[model samples]
Structure formats: structure tokens, C-alpha cells
Target: MIAPTLHTERLTLRPLALSDFEPLAEFYASDRSQYVGGPKAADQAWRTLACEIGHWTLRGYGRFGVDETSTGKFVGMVGPWFPDAWPEPELGWDLMNGFEGRGFATEAGLATREYAYKTLGWKTAISLVADGNTGSAKVAERMGATWESKLNHHIFGDVNIYRHLNSEAV
Candidate 1:
């Protein structure tokens, strides 16, 4: 099924498209790379986008484009990413450098969590934040996620686990 578009007061969360590769590549190519696993060549970025599309096809949902409501420009990405051998569902996000410090990540993340719990019927969600990513940790906290455990997130290296149980928090 085509995933429904999600709206926030200042942003829109929608399924990513192939057309997003360029802007996404540019977004990644610029700053904000550190927060998103570093930069990639344009070709590699396209391949990554293709893989993300495939992930959505196989898993039913994946990261959606976070766009500005008024401008419709891609600001970044946010959604669920299931890592290999991961013990639980993970909420992930990376906002463009320009969008940082504007509460976009927090707003988009909360919306994604709501969609996961209410629309997708997820009872719980987890966020694995890199130890140095204080901003993300703050967002997780704002989403009612508590620090659960520390784990070595294979893809992102060392991380702090944060948990949010829909029933208890919402």
C-alpha cells in the first residue's frame, strides 16, 4: 500500500521518491553528514536511496522525506530503520544542517512515533542515538523515551538505547 502522507504543524512527512536522490544527495554532500553516517558520493547516495526504497517495499515502511510545509523542500529524513540483528524497532532521523536547531527533528520524530503506534500498531519503539549526538538524545527524551540500555549499534557504532512504550507514554 502507498503510505499515507503525514502532516505536522510545520512539515510534511511523505514517502521518498527516486526524484529525492538529488536533493538528498546534496543534503548529504553538504554538512549534516556526521549525523547521518557521513557523506557519500552522488552515485552511492542514489544507490542508498534505491536500497531505502527496497527496504520500504520489503518492510512495509521506512524513512519518509521530511519537507517544509510552506516550501515543500526536502529538509531531511525520519522514520524506522531496522538494523540487522537489532533487538528492537528503531526510530531514526537526520535533518539537513539548515533545519537543525529549529525543532524539525523533534516534531517529525514525534509524528513518526504516532504513526507507528496508531497507524502501524507498534506497541513500542526504540531510538539508538550515538553517544555524541546530544540533539537526538534530547529529541528522544521529548518523545517520552527513556534511556533503556547501552548497546553497540553495529551500523552506527556505540549508541545509547532509548525506549518509548506507546501504552505508557501516550
Candidate 2:
């Protein structure tokens, strides 16, 4: 199941693609990616992007490449994600370095949460935010999520799990 393009007020959440590699690689190269398992080599970024693509085929839902509607510039990635190790479907979001402080994450997060519930038939969702990533925590809060528990991830260590609104709320 390919990810369908979703639209927000100022952004277009399209399917992730091989073409997204360069910009995603550039984003991952910066120190800003530390919280999301980045500051990695371009090859690592390639694998990450490839994994996102594979996610759609395996799960029928995955991250969307967020593009600014007016300029068509790739601004970030946001949507539902659930790897096998996850406790539940996740309303994940990540805005590019320059696109922060503009409410893009909040906007995209809300849209993705709605999609997760109404379209995907998910009863609940979570945002696995790395501890100390206050920005993402705030975004989750803005999307009507609240801290549920701490998850001990082998590689990322402890992460804050934010439970999103139940499907009934949608």
C-alpha cells in the first residue's frame, strides 16, 4: 500500500521516495539529527530513507515527505509509523532544520494523528520522543498527546512515549 499524499494548510505530505535522499542526507549530516539517530554518513542516510520506503510496503503506512506547498521544498517528514518493536502505531514528525519555529511540526502532527485514527483505523497512537527532545515533546503535546511512559530502547536508550488521542476523539 503506497502512502497517499496528504495536505495541510501550508504543506504537502507526499510519499517518501529515492529522490528524497539528497536532502534527507544533508539533514542527517548535521548535528541537529542527533536526537533521531543521525549525524550519520550519507550511506547511513540512504539506508534510513530506504527503510522508510520499505515501511510503506510492509505496513501499509509510513512517513510522508513534508514539502512546503508554495515552494515545493522538502521541509520534513511526518506521519504514522510502526516498526515491529514499537508498542503501537506512532504519530511521528520531524521538520527540517530551517523549517522549525514555524508550527510546521504541529500542523503536520495533527494531520497525521487524524489520518492514523480515521483512515488507518488505529485505536491509539504514540510518539516515541527521545528524552531531552523538548521540541518534539511539545509537538506531541500540541497534537493532543501526553506522556505515557518511558521506553528503554537498546540503541537510543530511554525515550519518552507520548500517547495520542484515542480514535474516538477523531
Candidate 3:
């Protein structure tokens, strides 16, 4: 199923669209993408975006392209992610430059986690933060996630996994 649009207090989380390519590609090309494996070429960025979109078809749940509600400006991507070989379904996010330090990632992440449990019937989820990605760690902490363990990811080596409580069960 296509990802349905989600609204938050200050953001709109919608399905990733073709129009998001330019900015997202630029984001991928920048050093700011270090935590998410960036500084790549435009072609690589395109493939990454394609993979995010393709994930929905494969798993019925995937990332949402987040935008500022009032301005309709793309802010970032946030949502459920569970690739093959992943230790668990994860709630992941990437906030573009100039948008960090705000609460966008936390707000969007909370919304996505709610959807993960309520809509997808997930009992638990993890946030995979690359070691030393303190920004993401802070967001996860703000979202009520607790550091669970560490694992060496195939793609992102030496990752910190934070576990979130199932809101429904709380």
C-alpha cells in the first residue's frame, strides 16, 4: 500500500515523490549526510531514493518524505524501515541541513512510531544510530527511546540501537 499522508503540529509527512529528487540528491551529496552515509554522487542519491520508495512495495511500510506544513518545504524523511538482514524494524529519519537542531526529527519520529505500532502491528522497533551520531541519538532519546545495545551493521558499522516502548501497551 502507498504511504498515506500524515500530519503533525508543524509538518506534513507524505509519500516520497519525484519532485523531492533535486533537494534530496543535494542533501545526499553533502557532508551533512555523514551519519546516513552520504557525500555520494547524484546517481547514488537517486538509487537511494528509489530504494526508499521500493521498500513500501516490499514491506507495506516505509519512509515518508516530511515537509513543513505551512511552507510545503521538504524538511526530511522519517518513518519505519526494515531491510533484509536488519536486526529489527527501525524508526529512522534524516533531517536536511538548515532544519537540524529543531524538533522536526523528534516530532516526525514519534508520529512514525505511532503508525508503526498501531497501523503495522509492530510490538517494538529500534532506531539504528551510527556510533557518534549524537544528533540522532538525541532525537531518539527525546522520542522516549532507550539505548538497548550495539551492533555492527553490514552497511553502517558500529551502530547503536535504541529501543522504543510500544505506546499502545503503555
Candidate 4:
């Protein structure tokens, strides 16, 4: 099924398109990159978005382009991803610098988690965060996920695992 657009008080989350690369490129080039594995060059960003698009076709769901509802500006992305050789589904997100600390990630994440469990019937979901990425870890915890274990992510490199089980309360 095609993933539908989701909205929150201040943001709109929808599937991304190749045309979004321009605005999203700024986030890829910002200092926030350290938390999200650092800035990717424009070319690499293009490659990443292409792969993300492919994930949508193969996995039935993929990242959504986050935009501010008030201004209709692209802010970031959030959704499901499967890392190389990983055996489970993963929840992931990245917000632009200007949009940080506003609870956008937490809000969007909660909605996605609900869709994953209640709508999609997923029993569990996982997130891989960089060891030093306290922001993301906090968001995961707010979504009712607990620390699982530290694992070397072949794609993102070193990371910590956080998981949410559908059987539990959020």
C-alpha cells in the first residue's frame, strides 16, 4: 500500500520525492550531521534518497518528508528502514536544525509508531542511534522504547539499539 500523508499540529509528514533534494540538502550539510552520521555531499545525498525511494517499493513503507504546516517548508524525514544484514525493522528520523527542540520528532515518531502497531500490525520496532545522540535516544524513550544492546551497524557504523514492543504501552 502507498503510505499516506500524516499531519501534526505544526508539521506535515509525507512521502519524499526526488525534487525534495534541494531543501533536504541543507540538513545533510549541517552540523546536525554528527548525530546523523555527518553531512553527505550532494551526490551522496542523492544516492541516499534514491535508496530510500527503493525501500518504499520493496518494503511497502519508507521515510516521509517532514514539512512545517504553517510555512509549508520541508523540515526533515521520519519512517521505517532496514539496515544491511539487520534482521528486524527499524524506525528512523532526522530533523533540520531550525526545527529541532520543538517536539516535532517526538510527535511524528509517536504517530508513526501508532501506525506501525495499530494499523500495520507490527509487533515490534527498533531504532539505531549513535552513542552520543542523546536527542534521538530521548525521543525513542519517550516512544516507550528501551535500550536493547549496542551493535555495530554496518551501514551507519557504531550505534546503540532501542526498541518498542507493540504489546506494551507508550
Candidate 5:
């Protein structure tokens, strides 16, 4: 599947690549990843990135690797995803270490949400932010989402699902 490229004022979202592995591995190895099922070994991180790419091939839509347009630095992954056990398609985002505090996640997330609604023809979208992840919760809120419910998955534990109130707002 050909992944479409998306852009914001400061970032560009594109297909995942081999170059994304190192930083992704670093993120997964750190405690910051706990909310997103991280603290993984290098190999696990590799497989995880691979799975992200394959998600596009199989599902025709998946997370995009985002980079800072000005510096061309990788920031993180953000886009639409619906993994095996997920209840439904969702808009998700994960930022690299130094990228947090910059609102990059929210920017990319809003773009993905718009893509899911306008480009993918989705009527509604939700962001499955992990419980206790205040940072992500803030991003969701900034994107105009409101917590609507919670979900408990065998792997992800408890996560709060924030529903997008206006799909056309984007």
C-alpha cells in the first residue's frame, strides 16, 4: 500500500522507514514508553516498527512517522490504527524524547484525525489514550476530543477513549 504524506506547519508525516528503528528502539527502551507498551528490547522494537509498516500493507492505513520539517529530524509516529484486539479504528500519536513539550503530538494527531475523517471517509474517530498518561490526554483535549469511555484490553490494560465531537472541524 502507498502511504500518503501529510504535513502541518512544522512537521511532515510519512511512511515508516528503516531509519526510524534506532530512535523508536530508544523510545521503547525508556520508561516513557510504559504508556504505549514499551520498555522493549532492541529486537522487539524492530519488530514493532515492522508491524507498523505492515499495518499499512494489510490495513491500507497505519501510523505515519513524523519529522520536524525545519530540521528534518524524526519526531515520532502519529496516525490511524486498529490493531488486532482494538475495539475500533483510532487516532494515535507517540512523540520522541525531545519532541514532547512542543505540541507536536497534538499537531500530528489533529492531522491524522482529519485524514481519518475526510480522506478515509470515517464518520467518527476516537483517541485511545492510556490511563494515567496525562501528556497524551492533554493532546487529545487540545484536538477537541472529550473522554467518552474507557477500555480494558488484555495487553494495554485500561485506556481512556476520547471521542472526537466534530469530525468536520478539521
Candidate 6:
């Protein structure tokens, strides 16, 4: 089955594609990727993209590659993610290099959260932010999510969990 595409005023949240590899690898290899388990080797980045694509195949929903509507430039990936080992379903976003300071993440994050809540019928959603990643925290805040709690994940470490408001708050 084909995944659905989401549209925000300035972005198009579409399924990941092969063309995203180079950018994804560049992002993963840079210091900017630290918060998202990056600074990885090229092969590792390939595996990461493969896993992201596989997530949709297995779970029926996963992150979408974010693109700028006007330029059609790939900016990042954002959407609902729920690996079996995760504590709960999560709304996550990773902006590519040089895409920070823009409202792209905020715009895409809101759309993904709404998709999870209204379309996927989720009652609640949370975004996990690496402790020092102030940028991600700001994106969460911009989308009306509140700081929920802190967790020391086996993988991510020193994480801050931000919970999105329920439907009534939307």
C-alpha cells in the first residue's frame, strides 16, 4: 500500500525516497546529528534510512521526508514513530543541516501530530528530545506540547519527553 502524503502551508510530508540518501547521510555524519544518534558512518546512515523505510512497511506509519513547498527542497523527516521497544508512540522530527531557525520543523511537527491523533486515532503523543537539543524542544513548544518528564533511555540517554495536548486542546 502507498503511504499518504500530508500538506502544510509550506511543506509536503511525503514518503521517503532514494534521492533522500545523500542528504540523510550528510546530516547523519555531521555534528548536527548528535542529538539523533548520528555522527555515524556512511553505511550506518544507509541502514538508518532503510530502517525508516521499513518502519512504514511493517508498522503502517512512519516518518515522512519533509520538503519545502515552494522550492521542493528536502529539509528533513518528521512524523509518528513507534518501535516495539519504545515506551510509547512518538512524534519526532530531524531537520537537515542548515534548515534550523526556520519554522519547517514546527509546521511539519504539528501536521504529523494531528495525523497521529485525528487520523491514527491516538489519544496522546509525545516527542523525545535529547537533553541538550534546545532546537527540538523549541519545536515541541511551538506545537503546543508541554514538558512531561525526563527519561534515561537505554539508547538515547538523558532524554526529555514532551507530551502533546489531547484533542480538546487542539
Off by over 4 Å in 3: none
Error of 2 at 20 (Å): 1.4
- Model 2 ranges with Cα > 4 A deviation: none
> Please, what are the lDDT tens digits per residue for candidate 5 over residues 59-134?
9999999999999999999999988988888889989878998999988988888888888888788888898999
- Candidate 5 — which residues are off by over 4 angstroms? 168-170
Worst 10 residues of 2 by lDDT: 88-97
Error of 3 at 119 (Å): 0.7
Clashing pairs in 6: none
Pairs in clash, predicted candidate 2: none
- Each prediction's TM-score versus the true structure: 0.90, 0.96, 0.97, 0.90, 0.96, 0.97
Candidate 1 runs further than 4 Å off: none
Error of 6 at 33 (Å): 0.3
Q: lDDT for every model?
A: 0.81, 0.87, 0.92, 0.80, 0.90, 0.91
Those runs of model 4 whose alpha carbons end farther than 4 Å from true positions after fitting are 167-170
lDDT score, residue 71, model 1? 95
Question: What local lDDT does model 6 show for residue 129?
Answer: 96
Q: Sorted on lDDT, highest at the top, how do the candidates line up?
A: 3, 6, 5, 2, 1, 4
